[model samples]
Target: MITEAEKWTKEFYQKRGWSEYGPFIRIGFLMEEAGELARAVRAYEIGRDRPDETKRTAGELKRELVEEMGDVMGNLIMLAGMYDVSLEDMMEAHRKKLTERFKGETS
Candidate 1:
């Protein structure tokens, strides 16, 4: 399910006046954000180490991961708004599909 925070994030993007971009540009930007989120995930999983500098602690890395994740989700929500897509309905359908696919799995 899309959380209350996701709803607020969509509104935040709207308030920032971000709907001027075309879908192609927005989708590309969303993909870029997703890439950053992936990097954050990698950092969280393995230490963000550099031979020339000190490695970040797991907690610090987690904070970075969370921020990157929010960026990705914000873009997604923005795209949904631009396309007139209802994330709530989409998530519900997705949940139903997953429930059928994995009957015994706990959501």
Candidate 2:
């Protein structure tokens, strides 16, 4: 199934004329998004700029985190598109490497 993110990414790049931005530029953008996400994480951990909820539920906190994470992932997906890198394949390869590295470990 083509995800909403994939569709949005395609249309976004097309609308912004970002298809001309090669892998190098996209990688820089990806780094920028990662930094933004990291800053968001730090703020959340320090209870800064949180919602005015009496009891900050896990869902509320997670929503904020996920929004930042989504930006990071969006940039990563854009970069992958620029380079013809399949995230699914990369994830599978990463999983295999991790499994091999932690063969004797149990959570």
Candidate 3:
């Protein structure tokens, strides 16, 4: 699943000349997207804190959360590419580390 997305992410950036933007730019994007995701998550589940954003319906807020999540993931994939890191490898290592750390937690 992540492998396919990584390939697509590389191509997407290359085709748009965004690959030249470098790792720092991608890092900046990741930070911005993460913040957006935080706000989206809060808005969707806890109702809006700001007056202007209050009009959005639950469905709209949920969609916003989903979109922000996609943005965050896409940025992460691109940043991984910048560092020559494969998401598949990242996934495997993550799985190994967590599995070892919490040996009997899965239910």
Q: Which candidate has the highest lDDT of all? A: 3
Which runs in model 2 stand beyond 4 Å of their true positions? 1-4, 48-64
lDDT of 2 by residue, 1-107 (tens): 34577778878878989767878887888888888788667656765554673556567767878888987777777777766666776678899999999999989
Model 3: per-residue Cα lDDT at residue 87 = 78
TM-score leader = 3
Ranking by lDDT: 3, 1, 2
Relative to the unseen true structure, what is the C-alpha lDDT of residue 4 in candidate 2, on a scale of 0 to 100? 73
What are the lDDT scores of the predictions, listed in order? 0.80, 0.75, 0.84
Cα lDDT of candidate 1 equals 0.80
Clashing pairs in 1: none
TM-score for each of the candidates:
0.76, 0.73, 0.84
Candidate 1 on 5-105: residue-level lDDT in tens? 76797667668877677789889989999999888898788755669867887788889899898888778877877766667976888989988999986
TM-score of 3: 0.84
Q: Which residue segments of model 1 deviate by more than 4 Å?
A: 1-7, 103-107
Clashes of each: 0, 0, 0
Residue 3, model 2: Cα distance from true site in angstroms = 4.1
